[model samples]
Structure formats: C-alpha cells, structure tokens
Target: MTMLPIQTTATAPVATPVATSTGDPALPLELLELELSLDGFSGDEASFAEAVRQAADQVGGDFLFDLPASGLAEDCLRIAALRVPKGENGAPTIVFALLDAEGATIRVENPDETTKDLKRFADAFVDVLQRI
Candidate 1:
C-alpha cells in the first residue's frame, strides 16, 4: 500500500467516532484543515453514492468499505479505518469516522496521510459534478 505523508505543524488529537465505531483506535494527527463542496449536486441517489465512493477511492489508507446505505441522500456515508502507528507496514485495525462536517461524507483513515488525498478527492468530485 502507498503511504501518503501529510506535512504538518503538530499532531492532531485522536478523532472521536462519528457513527458506531468498529473499535476506537487512536488516530493522533495534527489539526489539518481542508474544505470541499458540491455547490449544487442535482443528481439521483445512485449518483450520489457513486460520487462519494469515487471521492473515497482517491483518498487512500482506507481500512473498510461497508455496503452503501439504501438511500445516500438520506444516509450518512461512513467508512471505518485504522492503522498501526509505525506505518502501512502496520496492520489496519479499526476506528471511527468522527470528523464533524456539514453536507460532506468524510472519513480520514489516517489523518497524517489522507489529508492531502482527501483534498484532491474533493476537487475531483467537484470536477465530476461539473462534468455531469
């Protein structure tokens, strides 16, 4: 697995779980910040699910990919994740997707690594919307 390293000033506090956590693994990362928006995602439920998955594919370090909920627009996309402190060479245990954001499905598996990729994924998602 490719390890994406995020440049940072200090390590962020281990994030709290959003939905039900697989297991509360410690995710100590710096307080990184990034924002993305759909602007106007005039699409059906299936499109929404696909778009969310595509965005997640860009941001690596994923530990789990649960079955998509029946209704995406009505369901909060949740991705459980975890990694050993050493690196990808480490095992993928399990953690919570607890970052609080509005109108965005987010789960930073490894805060130190996935920050940049998440931003890239967000940009790509917007591009996907514009193309549609």
Candidate 2:
C-alpha cells in the first residue's frame, strides 16, 4: 500500500516537558510531547501506530517497540523508539515516545525535555518522513 508523507509547516513542535509525578520516591517523569494530525489517513489510531512502529523498524539501527502504560485515553496508543549506537561507542538515547490518538492525530514525545534531543528527533523522524 502507498502512504503519503506527513506535512509539517516551518513552525516547531512544543518541546516543553510536562511533569508526571507517580508519588514514588524516585524522580518525576518529564515528557516533551508534540501532536500531528493525519487528515489524509483513513485508518484508526492503532493502525497508524503500528504502521509507525514498522516504519521505524525498517529504518534499522534502532529499537522500536510498544510501551503499554496505564492511564492513557482508551482511544490512544503509545510506543517508543530508542537509538542504540554501534558497540559501546555512545549511550542509548530514547528517540521519542509515539502516541497516536483519535481523529488521526499522532504525538511524538521525548522523556527528557532537552531541546537538542527533541530537535534531533524531529529532524530525524519528521524531516525524513516529509521527504518520502
């Protein structure tokens, strides 16, 4: 099946970290999230998320897998893509946490709210997909 590319404007996605506290002794989880609406896609959120997971896997050199967490909206799906460097060269970085919701909208999130990391992920994922 042929799939069209996701269009993005020259604007930047929100990279602010929203804090989620689990009330545990450990530090809170800070997440950077961005949402994209897929107006052209006719499939449901699950299908879109699965397609994204497959696409990320096809790129190779990365770990793309599902992340089943509680408290998300029932109509949403979440996954994670982690960049695993070759050998012991560099530490692994979580590329993004992909969350697809109803109305053909997909959200890309980074646990760490660093602007640089989010920019790298957007450049790698969004730019490449836009060129497709």
Candidate 3:
C-alpha cells in the first residue's frame, strides 16, 4: 500500500461570521464540507491524489496537504485541503479524506453532498459541527 502525507499547521484559527440555521445558534463559520465517493478504479494512489487536487480546485481551495497512516493498515488514507478568504473568520474546511482499498471507495468527509445516498453522512457532519 502507498502512503500520503498529512499536513496540519498551527496557524491562527479564524472565527467565521454567524449564520443562522433553523433559528438555532448561528454558525459563525462560512465553512463548506463535502464528501464524494468514487468507485470503479484500479486503486492507483496517484490517481486518487490527483482527484483530490481536482476536487480542491473545484471548491476553490488550495491543496493544503495530506496525511498518511502507519503500521499494517497503511491502506487507509486521509487528506485535507483548505481555502481562506481575506477578512473571513475561519478557513474553509475540507476533510475526512478517507479511501477504502477493498471497496475501491473514496469517501470525502465533507458535509455538502446533496444526493440522496450521501444525505446521511452530510447530516452527521452537520450534527458534529453544531456541537462544536
């Protein structure tokens, strides 16, 4: 199995503007989380990385970096990218870069997939965000 790098920095975290959702406490962040599942590939790591780059571009974010796992379970992969706009409180977040080798599945831990199949993951992510 191949491994990708994980990148996390200690830059000053920004606080986003408060946005109301369902009359609850306004989410003070302009964050958009998206997850996408891809199948029917040969499981090429390079291709996967490229796909990630493309996704980041589509979301107008830069390829901040990725982190690879260690030990016997090296097949599990995670990557993260970011997009920050001037005067914005927090950086745009894209995460949970998960790739499942056996299932040939690439799961993005974002919360913006509006498709029926991925609604569950999106909802779960939003729930976590609310609690944070």
**TM-score for each model:** 0.26, 0.36, 0.39
Give lDDT per model, in order.
0.32, 0.40, 0.40
In terms of lDDT, which candidate is stronger, 1 or 2?
A: 2
Output the lDDT of residue 113, model 2. Answer: 35
Residue range with the least summed lDDT across 10 consecutive positions in model 2: 27-36
Candidate 3, residues 1-132: lDDT per residue as tens digits?
Answer: 122333423342221222222332422222232232132233545566666556556555554554453321235554333332212644444343445544244544332332223334434555566799
lDDT (10s digit) by residue, model 2, range 6-122:
345434232123222222222122112112222223455457655545444543335444454233324445545544332244434444444444334444443443334443654
Pairs clashing in candidate 2?
A: none
lDDT of 2: 0.40
Q: Which is superior by lDDT, 1 or 3?
A: 3
What lDDT does model 3 reach? 0.40
- The candidate 3 region of ten consecutive residues with least summed lDDT is 12-21
